[model samples]
Target chain A: MTITGKNKNKAVVESVAQIIFTVCASFAILAVASITLYMILSGTPAIFKVGLKEILFGTVWKPTAAEPKFGILYVILTSVVGTMLAILIGVPVGILTAVFLAEVADKRIARIVKPAVELLAGIPSVIYGLLGIYLLNPLMYKLELKIFAGSTTHQFTGGANLLSAVLVLAIMILPTVINISETSIRAVPPSIKAASLALGASHIQTIFRSILPAAKSGIVTAIVLGVGRAIGEAMAITLVSGSSVNAPLPFNSVRFLTTAIVSEMGYSQGTHRQMLFTIGLVLFVFIMLINIALTKILKKGAAEDGE
Target chain B: MGNDTLYQKRKRPGEAFLMAAIYGAASIAVLLLLGIIGYVFFKGFRVLNPAFLTTVTSSLKGTVGIAGNLLNTLYIIAITLLIATPIGVGGAIYLNEYAKPGKLVNLIEFTTETLSGIPSVIFGLFGMVFFGNVLGLGYSLLNGSLTLTLMVLPLIVRNTQEALRTVPDSYRSGALGMGATKWYMIRTILLPSAKPGILTGVILAVGRIVGESAALLFTAGSARILPKLGTNLVENLSRIGGKILQPGGTLTIELYLQMQNGEYEVAFGIGCVLLVIVLLINLLLKVITGNARKYGKQ
Candidate 1:
């Protein structure tokens, strides 16, 4: 093809347009990256000034008090324990649901179940929080789990404890696990099932031994994604976590890094505010590491599957 | 025959138990939806009177309507769609129509994917620094809308690209063969074909915008009353460059604030309203896409 003047000009314009779009998209990524960088860079000095042991191990979070301590061990524990609890509750149910959708359910039932999961995913966290406040809180009180030890007043009522946050987080992450697990299970080759069946294996045996084994890495990725979501979740945890900065015991009402950021960002100023940024930075690093790890694992899984 | 009998014996109870468990877990997903809808309606219905829809929230008990917040949510959706749809669609077109697979396109794809992964709270923080402080837009609807625009742009671009890619290449080739220019072929052949997908993207974006709480908390500062049509629009626009830049409280924010203040009844009521709106939008998308499919089949 001959390069005419008109064609050359058009090529120039198209290249320019592509460059501009690429830059715009790059800016969006940079926006997120810059936020993470700013949080870490600005927050580290405080972390250093306060000492890592004081920041991570100290019990108190009194950033504004005369003896300002910024220990985050409790918050970190709350997040990790809450996420673990969520995974414990959510993973089995989600895996079962995915197995059912992939292996047993009729097409008509699968269709209904699929969209229901989508709707579940789409329901906003605010509504989840509202439900927790109205339904879960009262239920906890009625179960006598709200009262601490022998207290009769039920004033504590476990209004926002590790249990409630974990339960909510479990529900929030369910769709993530279910969707991914279902897709992975469906991707398992029918030939594997056929071979197992030929060997006189039952459908159940085939699924557990042959199909699930093949989809294991994908299933792991799904669980990791769920953990990431549970760790980063804010609004639902905020409403249900009770937002107390006091070092959280297992039954005590507590705050995660996210809930702390949301609850304190409005009123906090000075170093107190910067510390909140530090908290955010902590959460950001935590989630970013999870995301990158998941991505790498997923890529390797894909490569292995391709082989 | 003996082997088959043995396999059947081994499989029957185990398969039955596993299948039952799977079905039980699947049913819970449906039950969760029912639980959410039922709880919201049960609590919210007690306070969902006509006054709640028509009047602004007041200091008086039993009169705290969400009319203003509803309007604010609507305004944010409108402004965000206005800003996001064009740019998002345009970017998608540039990717699909003009660009070849190169470093730039790959970079854009990577960036958009990463953007989608960032948590909303981070977006809130960025909005605070960039829009609120640096840009001097302060906490206003325009700032919130802009922040949301960035948040949803990747969704729009990805969806639009998928839609455009789904359009058969033959259509474009035929249009070009008929002496149509590249731009004309795209305008006439590609976009129209991808209309349903683009609209689906818009619907999804609206759902995110309406349900968003954290990002807007910083950008669109809390204001109880709806802005008036004339001076308010002007003042808001001038403040944020003729955009929706007033201190607006969306339903999500109102719901959060109400729950925070221990107004369970009102929060539930607002929650129901938001749920209904989202459901309706979803239903609209289904109907529209259903019709489009029907028409295409015809």
Candidate 2:
């Protein structure tokens, strides 16, 4: 065949290959979209039957008993409170660590700390739960805490409680906050720091006043991402949250949304399954709302930076 | 003047104390990671034996090995990588090379980001409904692999696309100028150049697949026995050919199940093993990519 004819044939083949690849890529996206649609559509009928008030506001969660109530307020509250607790404990420590890596520490120290944080990120949640059970629970007991205080008569044992869940979550999310905060702090202009130092401000003062403020948005994004992760975490929470559906009252044990879905899905029949899907949908909406809020904050921050 | 100097020096001491406290907090965070790993290793070492790696649970004694679980994890990894890697790379190539900036590409991007954000439990639900119920594959390795394929497809695509994007345009122009077709140029030039990125994606995907428990919970039913070798190979090949469905267990699921049953030592040991595998792969990829960059610069 002529060279021109061969080139034309190759172009046709290339076009065909491109079309095939696009179809496959598009199909993957469609599959995920369809999953979301299927859950929403299938779950809506149950939501309507139960009424949104009972599903969202009711306190009880007895799906297996003769009388079944599918309220998720308690679960949602547990997830929120647990995540907040994690953030409270993790954020300060993470910020300090970020500062240490970014400003206080030398490159060698930063290198060691950075990979250690990444390694922490890679540790499976199940292992975290196990560590909490073996170590944190015992430590809590040693401190005369009520971690194992009410366990004798309870369905579950020691080591599985809200505090334990929150502690583990704090550990799990530390890497995220530290990494992002460090990056943001590093991005602060060197001139700003030099100027602050030239004006007789100490390194610590300059970091807090200039660098921290400059990197505020990134730090906030890191915290938000950590919250998203903590709220959505399942296995760790399941293994630690005592798997109790009772309303979480301070030190009392509780269950989160993800835990409720995993623990109950095995035996959840009829409305129960739908309710679980509804819980997932609720979680999805919450994350999406947070993500949208985060995006808005980031855009505003960008605008301010531009100005 | 002496008194004022003394006051200033006292304030500096307090500042140094505060800095020490701040540094201490940061060090504690790093120490927490080391403490966790150390705790796991110390506890797990008691159970790290050949039998732990070789035997399958045969009786109610619960002292059995995780041989079957190990096999199942390997099988799932092989099947998932075989299915996901090529398609992920192909989709990425299309996105980087052929597709223009348009609605479809934007949709693809959105879908990938959303998929990455959705909780694993949701993926579990999707896998349960789609693979377990709709496809009628039942609870099998095929279903689990497919679920994971869906879960990691976006990640692999994004990574591969980024990798492909980083390849200089000059290479493409050079190839085209030599009268090479786009297909030939992509296959021989771009893909090879982006191999390290593709491998890094594969490594990350492997880490995820190895660690995934929630999605596999519904798709790959809690089977505790290893398939016979012949059957295993057949099933493996069929999965590669996109044909078979067999229920299997992964390392994460095994660890989860074991921990739930209070097999603490076993779970920790397996966790250590899994962590080692992941770290090894990550280090290997780092080394490979480091070398690739060095050579590329030359």
Candidate 3:
């Protein structure tokens, strides 16, 4: 074939290939677009009807009363408190565990523990729910009784409460925190550790002072990831969170944003159901905010690594 | 490697406490894992009789089995994988191989990362609204599978992109030098070399699908019966096609429903099976990656 004819054929093939690739790539775009649109379109009406301020900041959530109140303040508080507590407990434990695997543990132990963490991550949230229901709730119930035995002022709980949700959320988030923290800790340049040790700082001091600081960005990224997971988690929390829309006291049966939607979604209707979608919308926005933070932190971490 | 001596003098009080705390944290994690696995198995094993595996759950018969869920789980996995693999792999190829390093690639990557970070419950919400109601698939296995296809698409693309990147540029150049078309070269050389990653990605997606509950709940509905397989061979073949369009519950969904109904034994049994399956998948992943590394070294 002539060179001109061959070039034309090549151009045709290339364009065809490009079009196919573009179509495939569009799947991601389409997924994001459709999800956002659906959530907003379906989730907005209820918020408008309920009055945005009342739905968002109101303390009452009697969606089925003769005169229903749609305040989601308590649910929002429960989710925030639950996520914060999870982060508080989960971050320290996860960072310590990551340090153990990356710095303190011998290779064989690290090898074993690392896979266990991965396995923990792989366990379904539903199984976590199962465990939470069977194990954690009962334990929490006993603890609650013991703690509040003399206090008639405190509410009685059967153990499924915010505290139980926090505990489960903490455990659920460990995999993300540990994996990222360990990677970042290990990524801290060996030279930095050596120099710190050479300056007469003890091994522990060098790790604490030098390595942790150097891995700060990555560790921050890890925490952000943990926060994201904790806030977004639903199934496990739904099972253990005692699912009542109440103030987020440790012993109180509180509803989270995720659980609030799920517990009511099955049987809810009319404005109540629309409100659930609005709650979903709220959750989606929370997730998007977390995602933005994560992307920024990760980009910063990557840039530092490059440097 | 010689840094061991730096740790020899770590006898300070604070150092000892910190070291203890670190080890304690690691032990807690490992012990928690052991406790979870042990508890599930102990609770479940006694209930998992041979009859339990084979019988359909019947209130009249007073028997509980997950045969329907098992079959449904297999069907969902097969259908989800079938639909997702080609599109996801193609998207990955586009990103890593065909697309130039520019705005389009960046946009796709950003969107995929966003897609992944969106919680499964939101996907469940979206699936119920979009696939179930709008698409008129209405709470069927096919609807659930399509929703999952979107969820797992990012996983396959990211995995396949990583795999395709590991395929050295030399192969591409050599194929081009031999007058091979880009498609021919990718099919014959790049894909075969990247098979392990693709397979690993698919297996991981299977793991996600099997463990999934929240997303499947609304889209797949909560039917615990087997989708009607036909009486005859022709009917059976047609049944397979029809079943995908019908509502059914997989293992995870059944686990949730069982718990809701207070069937602790059945739920635990399902949890045990899920845990075992997850463990097997993790082991398979390790084995594949280990082999890949060994081969790369060679």
TM-score of each: 0.90, 0.91, 0.96
Worst 10 residues of 3 chain B by lDDT: B1-10
lDDT of 1 by residue, B1-298 (tens): 5687534654477678887888889888889988888878888888898989878977765467888888888889998999889878888887888778998776677667666766788778778877788789998888999889888998899889989988888999899899766766777888899998899899999988988998888789778685445567667656444436568889999999999999898899998898888788778877977987897787
DockQ of all candidate complexes: 0.47, 0.56, 0.69
lDDT (Cα, tens digit) per residue for candidate 3, span A1-307: 9999998898898778777877898789888999999999999999789899999889999999999999998988888889999999999999999999999999998989999999999999999998898888899999998888899787676898999999999999999999999999999989999999999898899989999999999899889888888988888878788857889988898899988877788899899999999999999999999888888888887887788
Q: Interface RMSD values for the candidates, listed in order?
A: 2.2, 2.0, 1.2
What pairs collide in candidate 1? B142-B244, B142-B245, B237-B242
Fnat: each model in turn: 0.40, 0.49, 0.66
lDDT (Cα atoms) of all candidates against the true structure: 0.82, 0.81, 0.89
The reply for model 1, stretches above 4 Å from the true place, is: A1-20, A142-148, A151-157, A246-249, B1-8, B11-14, B60-62, B177-181, B229-243, B292-298
Clashes of each: 3, 3, 0
| Ordering by TM-score | 3, 2, 1
Q: Which stretches of candidate 2 lie over 4 Å from their true place?
A: A141-159, A297-307, B1-14, B60-63, B229-244
lDDT (Cα, tens digit) per residue for candidate 1, span A169-190: 9999999999999999999889
Tens digits of lDDT, candidate 3, B70-119: 88899899999998999889899888777888887877888899998888
* Candidates arranged by DockQ, highest first: 3, 2, 1
